[model samples]
Target chain A: MSAVVILTPAIVAGWPTIVAAVAGAASALGLVVKQSVKQDIDIAQQTQATEQTVEVELAKSEVVAQNLAKEKEIVVTKGDIELSVSRDERGRCKVCAKGKGKTKAELKQIAEQFAQKMAQCFVYNRVATELKNKGFQTVNEEVMEDQSIRINVRRWVD
Target chain B: MAQHDVEIVISKTGEVKVHIKGVKGKGCLEYAKWLSKIVGSVREQKLTSEYYEPEVKSKIDLHQQLNDE
Candidate 1:
């Protein structure tokens, strides 16, 4: 062993990268990507009459974009519960969960869960891409019972 | 050639634990720096005994033995 390090992930990427991560998180959670446009949510909010709405922000995230209009949001759904992921005005990633029948606490919990899963997916994608670019070959990759992702990679250095 | 290995575990909440193996001297630190930049901020880090070993000594020794034959 040479070293052991613990890191906390921060998401800093463009809209396309964030969308890819959102797709990954949605698939992991069995949620469907209902739409990729923010206007869809605006219309749904007007018609759905949601009883409880909760917003959770990823603590360490920044959506870097050259054009403000390109910062589009994504909507994911699992039954009646809907999650809208977008970059807030402060550049932080935000996840909003709302449903008609669920309580405020329930919505909050779901929002938080989605936020964490999204962050996990984001970090996994980033690390895997970087490892491949750095000429490291993956030896093994697996998901633990607790849903954590483990990746082992090796490289030969002369 | 030296084989450098890394084991990365990304927790459900996106926290990462990285274990670097087979790298000697400051080369291990270079890996650490690259991973830190990719993932995020390093919360904690520890260096193991292998990090103090001479990086190319083993390979050089192998080359010298081959040349003697």
Candidate 2:
């Protein structure tokens, strides 16, 4: 046990990274990666059949054009549910999900799920990179009691 | 050697919850930044008592370590 502090999240990633995050988020949500920006949405009416769309524009984003393996845009769709993740003109990543047979509330839940997973993947990658740079040796890693990740690292400062 | 543990769970609806433990200081922020890049924008972050400790620096350049962010 060393020090712990909860931080105020600052959004500073470009579109490419956001695309990766979208893929991660999609995978977490059990959405299959069908194609890039082209999904087959087959919403069913039994689930209330209402469609909703949510788009969040990153305000303090600086898009980096570097070619990273995770930079490609990822599109996922399952059944009538469809999702597309891409960089906006301003380079902020955007996520959209639509289902025809599901209620608006259901679709909203799916969208929010995607958003959270995306955030989680992004944070996990960023933290790992920094720890390695700081020379913290990883002793153990695992899923913890509260659905969070516990990473053990040690380094000698003296 | 310290243990770096990351627990990633997707809820029934695909919402993800991440808990990072065992590291300290500003170094934790780097992890947070990297994950935000991988996942999406961060919605919330809580630094426990471990984050206040001093960082243990090895030979790796900060740039190389933080580039993932």
Candidate 3:
């Protein structure tokens, strides 16, 4: 490694970019895009009866969480489990998972999975966009060394 | 042309380690900031001396000069 100086990262993006980030995150997290007649996306709010919807928030959120606003929300459901992704009051993106048949632990696990995917998607979208804006073109991007996504970028700069 | 290369390793856990090459001065910070915005919070940052060196000036500068004449 040559003498390359590294500095603090500066984030320059607006709310619309955050929305795109969410869209990209949704795709990375295996969310299926459905056709909607209207502009707003309404989740299939089911469970029919007066069911319990437990909401749990993560306390150990990172400092970078402050870069977000309450822009977009993604609702994911599999079987009885329902998960919602949105940025919390603390600016940290959160995922709420609830279900009728699952125990509290099961719900927690699902929520945790959603949280992980959100984090991964957040990181992926952030990096790719930044590299592009700085004039770096992607050479190769892939998951490696235990499911990690590695991206190689090259650019001509002065 | 001078080539600036970046290698980003984002772990499955959402942690990232970035390696920047062929970029000098404050220009590289642009890439860093752009990335941190996407990836969430930064845990740690390690800056190499190349960051302190003069910006990477491509050989194309000479070609541009010759073309002007």
Candidate 4:
């Protein structure tokens, strides 16, 4: 090996790119996307009834695309849990999780987990695409027991 | 040409670990920089013994010549 590097991903992208990553994350976590209108109505009606709501900001992330319209968000559902992912006023990526019978800690954990999954999906897509553009062919790709993704690629360079 | 291999591991939390192989000298640094741009900030990095080896240009030329023969 010539070198080894450890990097922490910073997700900064436009709305479309963010949505792509969100879709990847949702699919990986077995979450279903809820219709926007129905999600809004449900959220409005359930806000008062749900005692636990937690919001988690993704670390080192910025949604650089400006002027995003209000209520433009991705809503996903898994069982009784609802997650809303959006870019806040300060351009930070935020994940809000709410469940009817869950505690604040439980909601917080769910939000944090979702945020991690989203970041992972974003990084994986970006790196794999870039490597392909650089003329590297993937030799092996697998998910480890601990859920980490490992990709090996090779290229003949002069 | 020299075959350059890169092994990338993206952790569950989105942290990336990259191991660049078959690239000697400063050439490996170029790959590291390019990957870092695509991924994010480098939390830590280490250069191995291969990084101190001679450049791969001579090896590439030798292989080309052998193929031509």
Q: Which candidate is the best by DockQ?
A: 1
lDDT of 4 by residue, B1-69 (tens): 789999999999999999999999999999999989998898999999999998844534444345554
- Per-model TM against the reference: 0.93, 0.57, 0.64, 0.90
Candidate with the greatest lDDT versus the true structure: 1
Winning model by TM-score:
1
lDDT of 2 by residue, A1-158 (tens): 33223333334575555666667666766778876532233223235345565554433444466344234456677788876665566555556667677766777666666665666666666666766786767767776565455555556543
- Tell me the docking grade of candidate 2: incorrect
Off by over 4 Å in 3: A2-52, A56-73, A87-92, B24-42, B48-69
Task: Kindly list the per-residue Cα lDDT of model 3 for residues A26-92, writing each as its tens digit.
Answer: 5666654333211243434432344445565543443243444444555655566666655566655
Better candidate number, 1 or 2, judged by DockQ: 1
> What CAPRI grade goes to candidate 3?
acceptable
TM-score for chain A of every candidate model?
0.95, 0.71, 0.63, 0.91
Clashing pairs in 4: none
Whole-model lDDT per candidate: 0.91, 0.57, 0.60, 0.88
Better-scoring candidate (TM-score), 1 or 4: 1
Name model 1 segments beyond 4 Å from true: A69-71, B58-69
Q: Give the per-residue lDDT of model 1 (tens digit) for A1-158.
A: 89999999989999888889999999999999999877777777888774688899999999897366244889999998889889888888899998888999999999898888999999999999999999999999999999999999999999
